[model samples]
Target: MTRRTVRIAMNGVTGRMGYRQHLVRSLLAIREEGGLELEDGTILWPEPVLVGRRAPALRAIAERHGLEHWTTDLDAALADPSVEIYFDAQVTAARAAALRRAVAAGKHLYCEKPTAASLQAALEIARLAQDAGVRTGVVQDKIFLPGLRKLKRLVDGGFFGRILSVRGEFGYWVFEGDWQSAQRPSWNYRAEDGGGITMDMFPHWEYVLHELFGRITTVQALTATHLPQRWDEYGKPYAATADDAVYGVFQLDGGVVAQINSSWAVRVHRDELVEFQVDGEHGSAVAGLRDCRVQHRATTPKPVWNPDLPSTEPFRQQWQEVPGNGEFDNAFKAQWELFLRHVVLDEPWRWDLLAGARGVQLAELGLRSSAEGRRLDVPELTL
Candidate 1:
C-alpha cells in the first residue's frame, strides 16, 4: 500500500463541536485506526495541528493524544508551508474571515457552516477559494448518518415510489440553567453572537431536502424566543434575544413538501433527538439518527376512530424495523474521510462554500419569511 501524510491546520478546535466531534471523534479516531486506506490502496495519514486561541488547552490536547503539533498562533500556522489544508470549527461569527484568510494563504479550505453570517460573504469565500485554485469543503455531516443513508438507499431502490412529503422533528429541552446548568454554550442564545434556531438548523434541513428530495423552491417559517431569559455558565441570567424555536415549511422542486420543526424548548418523544418521516405513494418510513422503520402501503393498518373505545390494533407495531444493512462509521468521521480524500486524491467534492452559502440563504430567507408572514422563493445559487 502506498502511504503518505497530509499536514492539516485545524483551527478553532477547542470548542465543544470542534473538540469533541471533529478533533476527538473524527481526526483522532482516524489516527488511532492507523489512517484511512483509499480505493487504490493509497493510505493517507492525516496529521492535524490543533490551532486555537488558548495555548494551554492546545498543549493539553496534544500531550493527551501524543500528538507532536499544537499551536495558538493562527498566523504562524497559516504561514507554514507544510500545512496543506485548513479546517475551521470556530463560532459562526469567526468562520468567514478565517476561511478567507486560509484561501488567501493558498491552502485547501474546509470548515463548519453557516460559513458566513450573510449570503454575500459566503459567496465571496466560495469565489475566493475558486480563484485561489484550492480544494474546498464544508461540513454536511447529517447526510452521511446511517439512518439517513438507509433512507437514501431505500429511496434509490424505488421503495418509496412517487415521494410525497417529509416531516422532520428535531430538538430537545436545553435547560434554562436556573438550578441545573444549560446543556449548550451560553453564546448559542445570543443573536449578536450569531445564535438562533433558524441559523443553526435550517442549513441541515436545506441540504437534507436538496440532496434527498429536491432543491427547495420556496420557504415559509415561524420563529420564537420561547424563553426570553437564560442563565449562563457563571449562573448569571442573560437576555435571550435570538430564536429558540422555529417551525418551517419548504416547497421542493418536485411536489414534495418538507416541514421541519427545530427548537431548543421542546421535549423529545421520538426514537432519537432528531427524526424524519417520509411519506410516499408505495410506502412510509420514519428514520432517526441510526434506525429506520418502514411500512409498505399494503401493510398499513386501518384504524377506526372511536373516542369511547381503545384502539384494537397496536398502531406503532404495524411498521417493521429495517435492519442495519452494514457497519457504519461515525457520521462526522465519514465526512471527514471524504474531505481528506478530496484534498489528497483530487476527488469530486461538491459540499463547498457555495453550497454553504445556500444554507445561509435559507436561514436568511426563513427569517424574512417569519417577519413578512409570507412564503419566500429560494433563488437558485450559481457557482
Candidate 2:
C-alpha cells in the first residue's frame, strides 16, 4: 500500500528552534525513524517546504534535509494546495499572524508554545481555528520528559497521597554573547519581542502543574531584570527590557501550593538543569530531567538537627538515583511524533490552542502581579 504523505509548509524554518528542533527532527523522524504510520498499512511521511526570510539560510536547510522545496513567499506556500499542514516556530509575536494565515488557507496547524503574545490574541486564534473547523495543536513538550512522566506515574499511582505542594527550580545561565555566543536569540531580552522568563516558561509550568497536581487558581509573583544590559555575539551591547528572573508562587485548586523559580541567570549545580520536588502526605519525590527519587514514610529518615556537628553525607545523597527505564527521545521530538500521529491517525492531542491560551494567561497574570505588588486571580477560559 502506498503511504499518505502530509505535505507541510514550515514557517520560520530557519529560526533557532525551527532549524534545530522542528525541521531537522521532523525530517529525520519521518524519513529515517519511521515515526509516523497510518492505519491503512501506510506511512505518514512529511513533505516539508522550508519558509523563511533569508533565501540562503532556507536553501542551506533544504539542502541539509535533501528537500527540494524552499520559499521566502508566505502567500505562495499557503496558496499551494498540496500543503496539508502549516507549522510555525516563529517568535511569540508572529505566531498568531502566521496561524491566522494558515487557518485561512485550510491547513492543519501545529506550532511552538505561547501561541501568541497576549492571552486575548491566543484565545482569538483558538476561536478562529475552532470556527474554521481546522485541527490545531500547540507544543507542550515538557510533559513528555521521562522524569516528568515518572513523576506523573507516581502521582497517578497514589505514591504521593494527599498531595501537598510542589517546588520547581528551572534555569541555566544563558551566556551574554560576549565571551561565548548567546545561547538564545536577542529577542528574548526584549519585551516588545515577547521575551521574558514568565512568557517563555510559565506555560510549561502550567501544563506540568495542572497535570501533576491541579489547576492553578491564583499567582503571586516577583519578577526581576537583574542584568539590564547584555552583549550580543559580537560584544555589541543591547538594552535588556525583559525580566531575566521570576519568582512566583501559584495557588492551585484544593490548597496545593506551587513555587516556581524561573531564570536565565542561575548556575546549574544540581543533578539536572530543571528539577521538581513534590511533597505529599505519604511520600516526597524529587524529579530531574535525568533522574527521579522518592522517599516514602516507610523509608524516610528521622533525624534531629545538631548545631555543633558536621555531617559526613550531603543531604542530596540521602535519596538514591532512579534508573533509566529505556531509550527516551528529545522532549520536542516526542511531541512532534505525537502531533504527527494526531494528524495522520486521528489520535487525541490534548495540547491545543486553548492550552496555549492558559499559558499566556498565566504569564499575563504573573506580570500583572509583579507590577501591582499583589496577588492575581487566574480566570478559567470560556472555550
Q: Which stretches of candidate 2 lie over 4 Å from their true place?
A: none
TM-score of each: 0.98, 0.96
Query: What's each prediction's clash count?
Result: 0, 0
lDDT of 2 by residue, 163-239 (tens): 99999999999988877888888889999778998999998889889878889999999999988888866689999
lDDT values of the candidates? 0.92, 0.87
lDDT of 1 by residue, 42-149 (tens): 888889999999989889888988889988888889999999999999999998888888888999988898999999999999998888899988899998999999
* Residue 17 displacement in candidate 1 (angstroms): 0.9
Candidate 1: residue 201 Cα off by (Å): 0.2
Q: Looking at model 1, how many pairs of residues clash?
A: 0
Model 2 per-residue lDDT at 359? 93
